[model samples]
Target: MKILLTGITGQIGWELQRTLMTVGEVIPVRRNEMDLTQPNSISGTIQQVKPDLIVNPAAYTAVDKAESEPELAMAINGIAPGIMAESAKKVGAALIHYSTDYVFDGANTTPYTESDKPNPQNIYGKTKLVGEQAIASSGVPHLILRTSWVYGLRGKNFLLTMQKLAQEREEIKVVADQIGAPTWSRVIAETTAQILSQARHHVSDFLVSKGGLYHLTASGQTSWYTFAQAIFAHDVQHSERKLQNLIAITSKEYPTAAKRPAYSLLISQKLSNTFGLFLPDWQKTLELVLSE
Candidate 1:
């Protein structure tokens, strides 16, 4: 089988290249090769490649910046996926897309479920929600995996930022009001591979029975302060790093253009039941990530 993968430079996309290699020939494309902003380009590229599967890990992920560039965000995160889905349908190919937890307003006391109604508060969230809707509306085989707080060893993410802060500053302050699971890119890539493997092997029932939106995040939950503290402790024990005075503050203290959810933890029960897969705890995933 042949697969067309986008966003090869991104954290999850980068890891996906390696994970997806186990399945079949992967035609990984970067932004230079296929610009998502141009919907016409997407259809033409997919038609040219004629891939059996399309994995779209690329997205407009700058949460704060998206507030100012809503049009660009919508174009890439919303309209592009629809175009890709349409093309995928034309060629009888399946599409796999990634989404974020920002789709919800973040007021829930419990983890967000697949069945929850999406009420996005920010431009980024709205755009991603649009993408999800487009894919769902398209009569194409698709899987929308909504993940949260994604970090990887190689990406410009929370873990890397915290590591830099720990090295430069004697003290650090992190938001304690917001809570969610910190997921690793490697783990997400592996899960995507597992899901793809299942789909490829069980072709008849794959899209009809199990192709839909699902939450895929590392298990457990913690505030940003707790997560930073854990990272510091792990770094000190594993490396010669030393950081002091880790302060936990409320969200009001640090302001951002976008209003983030107070609690955006996603429950993976539907994903687990559908795919027969379970992710490791957040802490364990962190350990493995840091070890690398």
Candidate 2:
């Protein structure tokens, strides 16, 4: 069982390299190796690799900048997955793709389920939704894992940004209105390995039966301000950084070019029901990541 893993340099992909080795031979594809913007490049690389499974975690992740580079975002986030799915299908392989919670507008007061209607508010979200729809329409055996508020030690994420700010500045302000789970990238990788283990043990029917969309995220939800405060309180206080305070502000006060969901909490019951797996709370994962 050879696995073609994209975005190996990314936070999740970095951890996946360690975890997926237990499952099968893992092939990491860096950007220069296979550019996602080039549709021909994707198909050529997948055909050459001929992996039994294709796991894509790469994307045009610049949320605010995506508004300016709509075409680039569409090519990477929208069209590229479709090409990969087509390639995977031709090789009789399954595709495990990661998606974002931003697919929905911040309107629902409750946690979003797989059945919820997606009404993306930003170009980034719209393009991601396009990719999701295209993969499902292609009728390939796939696992569309929709996660939210992802962070890791080695990436451009909220936790790293807050840690840098706490070290340099005495105090920092963060948006509190936004609510979602802050999932650690390591947890996502570990869980994916578990899912793949079970799928591999079973026949192809296992993936075909369970190969729809599912929410994979931390158990609990939180706001950006609280999440930042926890990160600071955990390690910053002990270090010489000496961070003073964290100010909680509304989303309107701290605006961005790309509109974000105020409440994009995703319920992971579907993932648990199918795979019998669940992640720790957002706060707990933060502490665990900091501890290591």
Candidate 3:
């Protein structure tokens, strides 16, 4: 099977390159080759590749910066996926797209499900929700996997930021109120591979039966403050740590351009029920990532 994978340079995409090789003939597309910001580039690339499966992990992910550049963010995150889906439909291909938990308002105490009505609180979340909707409405066989607090060894994420701050600063203040699961990128990629590999018949047929919106994230939930503490505890370079104090603060303590959800924990039971797959707890995934 031919699989066209976008965002090859991203953390999840990088891991996907390793995990998806066994599933199909992977065609990795970098940003320059298939920029999500350009609609023609998106449709053009899909038309050219014409793969059986199009896995898109690329998006304009700067949450705060997206407030300032809503147009660019919307162009990439909102408009591109629809074009990709339309193009995929033209070529008889299925799509696997990644979304975020921010699609919800974080107003609920319980974990979010696939059927939950999304009320995005910020521009980034709003755009991602638009992307998910576009794919769903485009009549393309697709899977919209919503995840939260994604971090990996490579890329600018919470884990690397904490490690860098630990080395430079004596004290670190993380948001204590906001809650979500800290999912490793490799887990997302590996799970995607598993989903595709589990295809009993044709790839498109598999997606037709199982494709829809599903939450895929690490098993457990924690606040940013607790997650930072866990990171410090399991950090491989513990000896180089200069962090003496890890302070817990409210969302108001450190204001941002975007309004983040206070509680955005997504329930992955649908994914588990459909695919019989489950991700490790956040703590265990963190340990595995740090060890690697």
Candidate 4:
């Protein structure tokens, strides 16, 4: 099967290239070839590739910067996936898109389900939710995998941020109130590969029975402060440092342009039951990434 994969340079995309290679032809589109900001470029490129499956992991992911650059974010995260879906439908292809838990307000104390209403507190979430809606309405077979607090060894994420700060700074202050699962990029990619390989039997049947949306995340939850502590503790060099100086502060103390969810943990029961796949705990996944 020919699979057109976007965001090949990203952490998830990079891992996907490795995991999805054995399954089929994984074509990683070049940025210049398919600039999401240029709307026409999306459909035009999809038409040219004419892939059997379109897996889009590309998105304008700058949370804080998105406040100042809503248009660009909306175009890439909000508009691009819809165009890809429409094009995929035209060619009788399937789509697999990734979303975030930020789609919800994070007001709930429990895990959010696929049926939960999306009330994005910030522009990033709003745009991602828009993409989800667009793909669902496009009448194309699609799977929208919603994840949270994604991090990896390569990308600019909380794990690397905390590691760098721990090694460089004497003290690091992190938001202690905000809570969510920290999903590792490799886990997401691997799970995606597993689902795709299994769906090969009857792609249309899989879409009809198990498409739409699913919450795929690490099994457990924790705060930023605790997550940082875990990261420091996981790495011997960083752990030996005066991590005692690590301070826990409220979200109000460390203000940002975007308003984050206080709690956006997602339930994976649906995904587990549907695909027989469930990711390991956040801490376990973190250990795997750090081991590298």
Candidate 5:
């Protein structure tokens, strides 16, 4: 199968290139090659490639910066995927898109399900929700995977940031109130490959059965503070880096331009039952990521 993948340089997209290559011929397009902010460029790129599957890993991921640049966020994260979906529909191809747990307000005490109502509290979440809505409304066979707390060895993510800070400072302060599952980009890429390899069958069943937005994350939950501690501990054991102290603080203390959900943990029972795929715990995934 011929597959066209966007955001090839991103954390997930970087891993996806390796995973997807095992299944089919993957044509990865970077941002410089194909700008997502341009609607016509998105449509033109897809039409030119005419891929059998379109995996869009690119998105407006700057949470704080999105507050000041809502239009650009909407164009890249909201409308672009819809345009890709339309192109996929025209050519009878499957479209796979990634979303975030921020689509919902963290007001719920329990983990959110696919059926949960989305009330995005921030501009980033609202824009991603708009993208999901556009894809669903396009009447194309699509899979929207809503994930959270994504990190990897590469890219500008929490893991790399923590590693950098741990090297420079003796103590690190992280928020302990916000809780969610941390997902490795490698895991997401592997799962995406697994799903896409069986795309023909899964797409057919998903259209008639359980298809739409599904939560894809690690099996457990933890706050940022605890997660940072784990990272430090792991590094101390395996690497030369030694952390002196790691402090836990509330979200209010670590203020940002955007308002984050207190708790946005997503339950993935639906994805598990439908795809027969269950991701490992966050700790286990972290170990693998760090080892790599």
Candidate 6:
């Protein structure tokens, strides 16, 4: 099977490139090779590759920056997936795209499910939601997996940021109100690979039957303050730590250009029930990544 994987440099894409290799011949494409913001680039790449599966983990992910760059963000995060879906349809290929928990406004106390109505509070969330809608309407065989709080040893994510700040500052303040799983990139990648592996010889038919939206995330949830505490506690390189305190503050304490969901924890029950794949708890995954 031939698979066209995008965002080779991203956190999730970096890991997906490695894991997906076990299932098929992986053709990893960088941004320069297949820019999502360009419709011709997206369509032309798919047409050239003619892959059986097109796994796209690429998007405009800057939360706060997206407020000022709405057009650019919409082009990538909102319009790109629809174009990819259309392209995939022409080639009779299945698509797997990653989405976010930010599609919700974080109003509910319980974890957000796939059936929940999305009320995005910020530009990033709004754009991601639009992408989800596009893929669903394209009539293409696809799986829109919604994950949250993604981090890996390599990307510009909360995990790396906390580790960097731990060594540079004595006192670091984090928002305690926002809650969600701190999913490791490897877990997401591996789980996705496992699910696709089951499709095997009948990839498109499988996706057509089980395709749609599903929440894929770590088992447990935590706030940014607590997540940072875990990072420090499980730091393999403890010698690099600074002196003082890890302060917990509300979202208002540290305002940003975009308003984030106060509680965006996603329920992975649908994913598990459908694929029989479950990601480990956020804490366990964090420890494993740090240990490695």
Q: Which candidate number has the best lDDT?
A: 3
Global lDDT scores for all candidate models: 0.90, 0.89, 0.93, 0.89, 0.87, 0.93
TM-score attained by model 1: 0.97
Model 4 Cα RMSD, Å?
A: 1.4
lDDT of 5 by residue, 94-129 (tens): 788999999989999999998999999899999999
Q: How many pairs of residues collide in model 3?
A: 0
**Candidate 2's residue-wise lDDT over 1-292, tens digit each?**
7899998888888999899999888999999989999988999999999888899988878899999999999999999999999998998888989999999998999999999999999999999999999899998888899988889989799988887887788878899999999999999999999998887744246779988999999998889988987887676345657568789999999989999999999999999998899888888888888887
**Residue 207 of candidate 4: its Cα lDDT?**
82
- Candidate 6 ranges with C-alpha deviation above 4 Å: none
Off by over 4 Å in 2: 201-204
Candidate 6 C-alpha lDDT tens digits along 7-104: 98999999998999999999998889998888999999999999999999998999999999999999999999999999999999999999999999
Residue-level error in angstroms, candidate 2, position 117: 0.4
Among residues 3 or more apart in sequence or in different chains, the pairs in candidate 1 whose N, CA or C atoms overlap within 3 Å are none
TM-score versus the correct structure, for each prediction? 0.97, 0.97, 0.98, 0.97, 0.95, 0.99
| Clash count (model 2, backbone only) | 0
Where model 5 places Cα greater than 4 Å from the true spot, the runs are 200-210, 236-242
Clashing pairs in 6: none
Q: Assess candidate 1 and give its lDDT.
A: 0.90
Q: Weakest 10 consecutive residues, lDDT, candidate 3?
A: 198-207
RMSD, every candidate, angstroms: 1.4, 1.2, 0.9, 1.4, 1.8, 0.8
